[model samples]
Each structure stands twice: as C-alpha cells, then as structure tokens.
Target: MPRTGEGTTVRITIGRLAEITGVPASAIRFWERHGLLPVPERRSGQRRYPPEAADRITVLRTCQQAGLTLNEIRELQEERPRRAAMIRAKIAEIEERRTALTRAQELMAHALKCSEPDIVNCPKFREEMTGWRPASD
Candidate 1:
C-alpha cells in the first residue's frame, strides 16, 4: 500500500485493493477485462492501482447490487454528471426494497406467532395480504 499525502498519489497493489475493497482478485481482473475498470499499471510484472481506484471498485460493487449491468455502469462512469443521478436513483430503489423486506419480515414474524398450524389459514396473515388479489381469481 502506498500512502498518499496532500500532494502525493498512492499506488496500491492488487492484493491490497482486494483486501481493502473486499473484492476478489479474480473478479477485479474480470472487471478490468470487461471494461468496467481501467487496467492497472504493472510494475515488475505486478499489477498496481491508484488509491482512488479502490473506491471506484467499491462503487462498482454498489452499482452491481443496484441492478446496473457492467456495461451500463461503465457508461454511467463515463458520464460524470449522470453518475450521481444514477446512484441516487439506485439508492431510492434500494430503500424501497428495504422497506418492503421489513414489512415482509414483520408479516412472517406475525405468521410464526399465530396459533394456527397452517399459516395460510391465519387471520393475521390474511389481513396482511388483503390488497393482493390472486390473478387467477
């Protein structure tokens, strides 16, 4: 790991980037191959990346979780202004999913506490599912 000061740039090794970013070296190489990240410079046949590159890799992982394809994320990265907007949209989508998951968890907890052996027959479960009518019905 190369330390950066106010005016200095840091050079991080592939292993260090993987350790800091929690991304495997193989995946990092794959990302580079797919054009998601620029190829790192090689020193004595060892790959090295700038410190900022690790943060970029972390952002790429977040984008992947937010349903963006690698190509789409690469395009987003190319457009600086749109990158923030895309990230914001993804954050909102993730929040909505989190809220839905919380509600689902609460319903599951309630179902588990019900006295009925069959959760499908529980009144609380029925109440929780009120608005979702079966399409086949």
Candidate 2:
C-alpha cells in the first residue's frame, strides 16, 4: 500500500490527479497559481490534494467539455446551485446537438445508398428538404 499522509489525508498525488482528471499537471499547477484550485497541502515538498479536490477537478473538466469558458466556469463554481443548473443545461444542449447530428448522418447515408440517378431529385430527399424555407423573407 502506498503511504498516505498523516494528519492531512492525501487522497491523490499531483501526477495521479492529472492522470485521472485528464488534465496536465502543468495545467493543474496553473490553476492552482490562478486560485482556481485551493492550495493543496504539501508533504515532503510535493503537493497533495484531498479527495474533495478530485471532485472539484471533475467538475472543472465537465465545464470545459460543455464549452463553458474558463472564466464562466470559475464564476459558476463560485455559486453551487448555479453551477449545477449550468451543467444540466449544457448536458441538454449536448444531447440535442448529438440527436441532430445523428439524424443528419442517417439522411446522408440514405442519400449515398439511394438508387436514384440524381439524389437531388429523389422523392425522399425532396420530402426532407421541402420544409426548409428562406427565413430572411
């Protein structure tokens, strides 16, 4: 078993945290320098984070994946309820975009395998494009 810190519970090492969070150690160090992550306790000149810090880093990664800017994420993190709501909204947006992309892929696949000499003139393609009208009118 790897030695755990005494008095100060070291849940993860800097390298382990980086590996699990998919964030570079340098980035984590930068975040610490910027006051994004609380200053972790040092043991033998090496920084170690508590278990809760892992959760925080996960939330940070989630915000990043959701397209939230770093500043926006930082602000959101300052408020718990708002951060949860923002994450929920981001998840919904991602799902909606994924559904749209899947539909587009299906349509394109159908078009590619279509037996029609001209896919543009295919009835199915025509039906799919029928509802599209210029919104600028």
Candidate 3:
C-alpha cells in the first residue's frame, strides 16, 4: 500500500505517475522542466506527486495529439488572458489544413476515375485545376 502524504491523500513516485499516465519518466521530466507540470514534493530526495498529476499529463497528451506544439501547449496552458486568441489561431490553422487535405482528396479521386493516359495532359484534369495555385502562390 502506498503511503499517504498531507492528510489521507496518497503521494505517488515519478515512476508510478508515469505508469499511471502511460508517459515515460523522461517525458514527465521534460514536461516538468518545460513548466507544463508543477514541481513535485520531494520526499528524501525522491519526487512525489499528487494523483492529479496523472490527469494533468492526460490533458497534455491530448493537446499534443491535437497537433499543438509543446511551446504552444505551454502558452495555451499558462496564458489565460490570451487563451481565447490562441485557441482561435489554432482553430484557423486546423481549418486551413483541412481545406488543403480536402483539395488533395478531390484531385486524387478525379485521377482514380479518369481514363487519361497522362493526367497532366488530360483536358478534364487541366480544367479541374482551373483556380488551383501552387503552394508557393
């Protein structure tokens, strides 16, 4: 049984926190260094975290999976005044990516059904590219 620290709350070691959150200890340390996770209480030179650390790590993983960079995540977590603006910016980025992917999908779908020997020379393909511009444009 794990020992309780500060009343009946159980304090978990770093290894246990990683296991509970499915995050590596190295990553946990990295997050701690990056200010994503709060500094843990030290017990005899060993780090001990409250159980809520697992929940915080879960949120961090979820934000990362959503394509947020670590710096962006840190900003999102720490910047309360600009949080709404940051979220709006992220939403715009996602929408832009979605539009680009959808355009690519449309091109691929047309290519699959076209009977043209060379897609580039196909009149229909060229017509389909009417308003399309290079990424650099």
Minimal lDDT window, size 10, model 3: 1-10
* TM-score of candidate 1 against the unseen true structure: 0.74
Summarize candidate 2's per-residue lDDT along 63-95 as a digit string, tens digits. Answer: 777787777677776866677777688778888
Q: Over the stretch 35-116, how does candidate 3's per-residue lDDT look in tens digits?
A: 9999998999999998888989999999898789988898888848888888899899988888788879988898899899
Extract clashing residue pairs from model 2: none
What's the lDDT for all of these models? 0.83, 0.78, 0.87
Better of 2 and 3 by TM-score: 3
Give candidate 3's total backbone clashes.
Answer: 0
RMSD of 2: 4.1
Error of 1 at 19 (Å): 1.4
Positional deviation of residue 108's Cα in model 3 after best superposition, in angstroms: 4.8
Better of 2 and 3 by lDDT: 3
Question: What TM-score quantifies how close candidate 3 is to the native fold?
Answer: 0.71
Ranking by TM-score: 1, 3, 2
Rank order (by lDDT, best first): 3, 1, 2
By TM-score, is 1 or 3 better? 1
